[model samples]
Target: MRDGGETVTFDFAPMVDIVLLLLIFFFLTSSLGARQTALPLDLPRASSAVKESPALPIVSVDPAGKVYLNGEATPLTSLGARLRPLAQASGGVVGLRADENGQYGTVVEVMDVIRRAGGTRLALGTRLPAASGATP
Candidate 1:
């Protein structure tokens, strides 16, 4: 046999490693974003808003009328009692996060509760419009 031929091969290990790294990076980042918000909520859009401070007390209302105090599920009847201390500690300013599509009655009730809990000022949670690429 008198035949001379050369073959070239491409290694895919490096390419696969890069793809895996990218996948892991995206997965980690996406999960991290979810950590900022206690629960999933479709917040109302606002044209002007500022970054929320972590020091403020946070109250959230879900679409099903469930209430949350800084991520923990709280009963409507006892929310005021539980939130009172936080409100006072935060200087009577509380951050309220209510889902845009949630029950209007629940949101109103939550607001009333916040007021009764000694939260004199409310920092309503709203998302910046899609047109404006900003974080708040």
Candidate 2:
């Protein structure tokens, strides 16, 4: 009867746990985003083009017929060496991007090199046409 009452305090263990969980979640997801490093080029338009998986290696060809592998300027003759390992790592899947104005023969030669380099699956990159009546 002599003592009145005592003060209470909040526990911070739950708050710390929630913060840790959020930190881990962001760290994991950040690495899963698209990591393409290919050079920027005006890709050909295709009605059937679809979104490609991010795991594949990208090879880009500019209008002047210069080939780039994963954003690095590479000679067409040496592409085989770089592509072989990439194809093996990605289960033979490789992404190809060629500028619309690029020479047709160059594109064909690149494809042939990719095939010889152990790439069994090929994905050509193209932009999808805008919907009709859409403003720029």
Candidate 3:
């Protein structure tokens, strides 16, 4: 390349491709890690828990049977009304993050409230069971 009478060229196609890839990566991940409750709980293990799209509202039930709707504590009596709008907005789908140690009755009651609130699709959040003797 001669500096006196000629100019050098730069290829930006690779840079554009890399930028696009990163953009897509972040976009996909941002949606995948949708809003979740701050409470820490041990999720049950399942072999067939599938990820639902269009991220739905999260209903977290802690070990003591405390229920959180979108991270806000709400009485079970008012849960239906509180969740109705969210369920409708999310296309009648909802996510339930019940702690594995939570009482079964509480979970069932919560599910009933969810259904009464017009949630037609329920996704129970769970992780795959760890290998034997492996910390989850």
Cα lDDT of all candidates, in order? 0.88, 0.87, 0.86
Per-residue lDDT value at 32 in model 3: 76
Clashing pairs in 2: none
Whole-structure CA lDDT of model 1: 0.88
Top candidate (lDDT): 1
**Segments in model 3 whose C-alpha atoms lie over 4 Å from true places:** 1-34, 52-54, 129-136
Q: Which is the better candidate, 2 or 3, if ranked by lDDT?
A: 2
In model 1, state the lDDT of residue 31.
72
Q: What does each candidate score in C-alpha RMSD?
A: 9.2, 4.3, 5.2
Question: Lowest summed-lDDT stretch of 10 residues in model 1?
Answer: 29-38
lDDT for model 2 comes to 0.87
Q: Any residue pairs clashing in model 3, and if so which?
A: none
Query: What TM-score should be assigned to candidate 3?
Result: 0.66
**Model 3, position 95: C-alpha lDDT score:** 89
